[model samples]
Target chain A: MSNWRQMMPTTEAYLLDKVLYELHHKPDDLAAYNEDKAAYLARFRLTPELAEKISSNDVAGLYEAGVNPYLLRAHCIGMRIPEDVSLAALRSLMKEGDDKWLN
Target chain B: MAELTGIYTASHTPVMLNFPDRIPTELRTEIFGAYEAMGRDFEAGRPDALVVLSNDHLHNFFLDNFPALCIGVGESYESPIEHWLKAKRRVFTGDQAFGAYLLQEALKADFDPAFSMEMVLDHGSLTPLELAGLDPDLPIVPILFNCVQPPMPTMRRCYQFGKFLGEAIRRYDGAERVAILATGGISHDIATPRMGMVNREFDERLLQLMEAGDSEAVVAYATNQVHTAGNGAEEIRMWMAAMGAAAGLPFKRAYYRAVSDWYTGIGIGHFGENSLATVGSIDG
Candidate 1:
C-alpha cells in the first residue's frame, strides 16, 4: 500500500494546499515539487483521460466512464485539486454518483 | 393512550428536488408525484403530533458530547439554515409529557438517552416536514440520534431501542393522533474518500426486512453484512424504531428510487392505513 503521506512532498498542510500549488505553479526550478506531483500521480497511475476529465470537471463523465475511485475521491475532497474548480460541476458529479457515495 | 395514527420516513436525496438536469424530467415528475401521495396521507391523518427521528449533520450537534440519543422538549423548534433547503421556516411545539416518558422508558430499558431544550432541526428532519406539507405550528417531538458522528449505537442496541420505543409511545395518553417518522438512509456515502456511492440492492432488502418486522435479521445483517448497505446506515435505525412503533402494521412502499447521481436510494414507506389489530409486545 502506498503511504498517502509519502506520495506528496508536504504533509503538514491540508489537501487544498496541494491542489492550489498545482494550479498556481505548473513547474518550479526545484525538483522536489515535480517529484511530488509525479509520485502522487504514479501512486494512482492516473491515465491522461482521467486527468483530462478532472481538468474538465465532468464528474458524471468521470464516473460514467469508470474513472478510478482513488483519483475520484482525491479530487472530490480537494486533496489534490484547488477549491476554485467549478462548484456546479462538483454538484453535478455528486448528483450523478450519489448512489455510490456510501456504498 | 395516543395511537400512532401514521408513520413517515425521509432522507436527504442530495439532489435538486425538481431540477430537470439533475434527474431526468420524467423521473423527477414521478418522484414528486410520490411525495404528493405521501402528503395526501398526512392531510387525511391530520396528525396532532409527529414524532420525527433524525440525525444531526454536524450543523447543530458537534463532535463533543453529542448525545447518542437526544429528545427535544422545547416549546418550539427551528432549523438554523433554510436558504439552501427549500423548506419554509416553521416553529414546532414539543410534547413535554411524551418526551419525558420516552426518556424515562428508554433509561429503564437500559438505553442512556439524553434530553435537549434548545435543539435546532436540520435538513434531515426538515426535508420530511417539507415533503409532508405539515403546518409550521404543528406539534412535534424530535428524537435526534447519533448516526453521523462516531461512537454510534450498535445495530442490536438500535433495534432493541426500537422495541422499547414501541412500548413508550403506546403508554403515552393524549387526544392528538401521533405519527412516527424516521429520516435517513437508503445507501449514500458522504464526507469521506468513498463519497457518492449508493447500494440499491441493499436498500431494497432493508425495506423488505422492515416490512417483515424482522428486527433480529436487520440487526444481524447490519453487524455482519457488507458495509455498502449502510456505510452511514446507523441512521436507518431511526426508521427501524419508527417501524417498531407501528409493529404488526402492513406498510406500502410509496416510492423507491436509486438515483445514483443524487447518491441516494430514495425510499418512502407508510403504515397505519392497513394495520394489524394486535401486535405482540417486545420484552426487554
Candidate 2:
C-alpha cells in the first residue's frame, strides 16, 4: 500500500487534510489563514510539526506526511503558491518506476 | 420492460470547461464536437433518464464522512458546486423514484451504497453532460463512486456493481429507457509532479481492450497497473463499471486524444451495437 493510504486515518493526517480543505473551500477560513496563519491553524488540534508544515507551505512534507495529493494541489492553488514550487516538491518524491509514462 | 439503452464513458477535466483556450482552437473545436457526437448518440437512445456514474471531488464529502459508494435520491440536484468552475450554475432534474428503486435493488443485491436526498454534484457529473449539450429538462440519476479517496471499490467490484445495476435497470418498469454514462480518466496526472503528462500508451491500450469488448482483460489490466498511469487514472474503475453494464458489447471509440494542457487523456466511447461501427482515434 502507498504511504498516502497508510497515513490517511491518523488524527494528524486528518487534521492536515481538514485544514487544507477549509483553506481552499471556506472563504472566511482562507481569509483567516491569510491574515494570521498561526491563529487560523490554532483552531485545529494539529501537532507542532504539522502546523509548521502548513505554516511554511511545505508541499512535499505535507504530502509525505499523508495529505491527499489532490487536496494538497487544490490547496496550493487556493494559496497562490506557484505551480513550479509544488511541482518541484512532487518531483522529489518520484522514483525510478514512477512516471514511466512520461518517458 | 425498461431498456438499458447504452453504456458510455468519457474523461472529465476541469480545464475542458474552465480553460478551453489553453489548447489550439482546432483541437478545442474537435473535442467539443466529439462530445456533441456522443450527445447525439445518447439522444438516439431516447432514454427516459440518464444515469451518471462519477466521483465527488471532495466538494460534497470530506475525509470525516466519506462513503465508498453513494447514490443520490434527491428530487433535483444543484450541480457545478465549485464557484470557480467556468460553467453555469443550474439544477439538474432528478428521477427520485428511479434513484430509490436502484437503491432498494442494490441493497437486495448486498451492495450497501450510501444514499443522500440532497447531494450537490460537482464538475465530475456536470462537465461531461454540459459539454455533451444534453437536455436540461431530462431527469438524471447520479451514482457517485469514491475514486478520489483510497479504499475505493476495486475494479472488479465496480464491474460487479455495474452488472447488477444493468440487470436492475432492465427489470425496472418505471422508465422505458435509461442511458448510462461513466465519466473520468484515460491517463493523466493532477497536482502532482507529473501534472501535465498524459499517458498515450496507457490510454490507447486501455481503449483497445475496451474496443475489443474484453471486460476481463480490462478489469485485470486496470486493477493491476492503474497505479503506473497516474493518480487520476484510478477513475478508470468507472470505465470498468461501464464495461460491465455493456455486458460484453464491443465499444466503438467516438474520439480519443491526449491533451496534456487539459491534464487528462480525453477519450470518449460508447458500448452497444448501435454506436459507430468503426473506431475513431484522434490524437491532439
Candidate 3:
C-alpha cells in the first residue's frame, strides 16, 4: 500500500470534487465563480479552510488531502492555473520514494 | 440468437484527438492508422450493436453519488460532454432493448449494476469511437464502471462480470450480431507527479498476457502490480472485462506505442478467431 495510492476520499475531498465537477461541466457556474469566488464557494458550504486552500491554488495540499488528482487538475484548470504551475506545486510535495510508479 | 461478434480493447486518451500535434506527425499517423485498422475490423463485424465498456471521467457522475457499475439504457446518448474536446458532438445511438436485457441479466447474475435512462458520455467513450472512425449510426450499450474513483470494482470482479456478460450475450434472443469494445488503459498516470510517464514494461506484460489468453495471470498481475503502473492504469479493469467476455480466446495486438507526450501507453487489440473477422465469422 503505497502512501500515494488512492485511498477513500474524505468528505472535504468529495466536496472539492463536487465543486470542481460542477464548474468543469457548467460554464455559467465557472464564470460566476471567477467573478465572485467567495460567493460562488459559499453555495457549496465549503469550510473556510478548504475554501482558502482552493482560493490559494493549494494543489499540493489538496492532493495530500486525497482530492482526486484528476479532479484536482481539472480544478486547477478551472481556476485558470497554468499546467506548469500546478505541476510544480504537486512536484514540490513529492517525497523521495513517491517515484516508484515512474520505474 | 444473439452472438458475440468481436471482442476488443483500446486506450481512449483525449490527447490523441485534442493534442495530436503534441506527438510527432509520424507517430500520430501510425496511431491514427491503428485506430482506423481497428475500425475497419470492427465494422466488418457488422454488429447490430456494440457493448462499450468504459469509465466516466467525473463528467456524468460525481463523488456525491458514484456507482461501481452503471449501464445506460437510454434510447440515445450525447457524447464528448467536455465541449472542448477536439471531437465533434454527436448523439450516439443507444441499443436500449439490448441494454435493458443486459441490465436484467446482470441483476439476475447477482451483479447489481445501476441503470440509467439518461447518461452523457465523456472522453472515455467518445475518443476511441471517433478515432476509429466508426459509424455514428451504430447503436451502443454502454457499461460504465467506476474506474475514476477509488473503491472501484476489482480487476477480478470486472473479469467475472465480463464472463457473465458473455453468457448474457449468448442468451440474448434480440440481436444476432453483437460486439464488445473495452476502452481504457495500459499505463500512464493522470494529473499526478508522474503524469506523463509511460510504463511500457507494465503495458507490454499485460498485453502479452492478454494475447496468450492467460486471464488468470492477467487478473492476478493487474490486481497486484497496478499500483506500480499508475493510477490511470486502473482503467485496465475495462480490459479485464473484455478478456473475461472473450475468455479462452487469444488476443491479437493491433498497435502499441509508448507515446509519453500522449500521456499514456497506447495499445489496441482484439480477441478470438479472426482479429479482423467480420460478422457471423467470429466464434461466439
- The whole-model lDDT of each prediction reads 0.59, 0.83, 0.83
Worst 10 residues of 1 chain A by lDDT: A1-10
* The TM-score obtained by chain A of candidate 1 when compared with the true chain A: 0.29
Best by DockQ: 3
All-Cα superposition RMSD per candidate:
10.7, 2.2, 4.1
Taking the tens digit of each residue's C-alpha lDDT, what string does model 1 give over B95-160?
Answer: 766777777778787888889887778677877667656676777888888775445676666666
What's the ranking of the predictions by lDDT, best on top?
2, 3, 1
Clashing pairs in 2: none
Question: Candidate 1: where is the Cα deviation over 4 Å?
Answer: A1-103, B17-21, B80-86, B273-284
Q: What is the interface RMSD of each candidate, in Å?
A: 10.8, 3.0, 2.6
lDDT of 2 by residue, B117-178 (tens): 99888888999999989998899999999888786789999999999988889899999999
TM-score of each: 0.69, 0.93, 0.93
lDDT for A42 in candidate 3 is: 91
Q: Write the per-residue lDDT of candidate 3 for residues B1-284, one digit (tens) a residue.
A: 78788998889887777668888887788778888888998888899889999998888888878999999999999987875567788999999999999999899899999999999998899988998899989889999998878888899999999999988998899898999999999787777777777777888788778777778999999999898777789999999999888868879877887778877888888987887522211110
| Chain B structural similarity (TM-score) per candidate | 0.87, 0.97, 0.96
TM-score for candidate 1: 0.69
Q: What is model 1's interface RMSD?
A: 10.8
First chain of candidate 3, TM-score = 0.85
Candidate 3 residue runs with Cα over 4 Å from true position: A1-6, A77-80, A101-103, B276-284
> Which residues of candidate 2, in runs, are more than 4 Å off?
A1-9, A82-85, B277-282
